[model samples]
Target: MKNYPQAARILVAIDCIIFGFDGKEIKLLLIKRNFEPEKGKWSLMGGFVNEDEDLSDGAARILYNLTGLKNIYVEQLETFGKARRDPGERTVSVVFSALIKIDAHDSEAVRSHNASWIALDARPKLIFDHEEMVARAIEHLKYNAALHPIGFELLPERFTIPQLQKLYEAIYNIPIDRRNFSRKLLSTGLLIDTGDKNNNGATKKATLYKLDTEKYKANFHSFWNFMPDSMKE
Candidate 1:
């Protein structure tokens, strides 16, 4: 009657689909393969689960190791267990997606493993079931965008209203009504106008706004028209 007799065998792995928005296009962080099975190809940052670590901890460790990013907003995505998913071994990958501000981390380390931020619209062929993982991650992002306030995580601290609108449009892949979008966003009172205008390449200067972090974090669950009729459950 030993506890070891009741132990279960489970294979777990962490795959990170890091999403970044660079003002115009939505991009995904991909790392080129350095080992066999798919050497010299693009893939998501991932690693095997450790013996004494939780799934999230393993994911954070993998991300930290690859890009020196920490405390990012990581969420569990899906579990891929197709028999032929891995050619080297029979394993289950627990995928995680994170939204990181492009300017938050050092870019040099990220570029070391041939890492590059490829625009989602122009992504190359990916290895294993990673393409599927990225698709699911985008869907999750869309769904979450309609409900949660996670979109701000992908933007810089100080951003223009147009930039914010562009981020939303990029995530949804649909053009939002400019006037209505701006009105609704301003009505939320989550943004603090810095009273500063950006003079970078525009005839008319745009006012810069930053997320009132304390206010946002405190009242993130406030009522809003986030979810559409389809997502209502």
Candidate 2:
């Protein structure tokens, strides 16, 4: 090992992109910045990493501190290390993307940060590189939704077929043919009708369904098609 001069100190931070789905749209959780260099602007939940903490731990801690949510489905995204990324310090940031049910977490701490869920299509301008971070997170979500069953994370335990279709439509940002969509999803045999109906003032009650986890696990290989030529590599 070689010794160098004392001018090489670097700082590390963790930023979390928390994505939520209402029945209609994909939304992002944003906090109003309270510090200088972007004060009063919208930003992702983030903080400096403590000396003894792992990057994942730091990301989780920051999210919990801001939103009081723990054990969410978070995955490590790319690290951003552009030299001028932060004007206040030589900082490198490890970003994480999380998918969570919109109403599953504590809301008090989030309110303290002036946090709000904004629809992805109508998000406010964010501070720092947070906009880039969100773009990457959306890309990751789109890819993962095509290949895995992770889209269920954005929904409640039990949902109707229409609800499931709406979730996929929100992720894809396009209209899906109701007939084809219903045919494909029903043919999968991964959904079980619960013998119940969602009777929330609709003219006709729609049947509720839940995932057959065992079957989903067994047939996952044939359930998803991520290699479609239309998907960008």
Model 2 lDDT-worst window of ten: 224-233
Each candidate structure's TM-score, on Cα atoms with residue i matched to residue i, is 0.90, 0.87
lDDT score of residue 124 within candidate 2: 94
> Among these predicted structures, which one has the highest lDDT?
1
lDDT tens readout by residue for model 2, 137-220: 898888888877777778787888788778888898776666776786777678898999888633138888888989866865
RMSD in Å for all candidates = 3.0, 3.1
* Decoy 2 TM-score against native: 0.87
> Candidate 1 on 1-233: residue-level lDDT in tens?
27688865556778999999988889998988999889998999888998899999999988887668899888898899997798877779999998888888768878776789999999999999999999999989887887667878888888888888788888877777778778877877789989999887441389989998997788776665543333344
TM-score of 1: 0.90
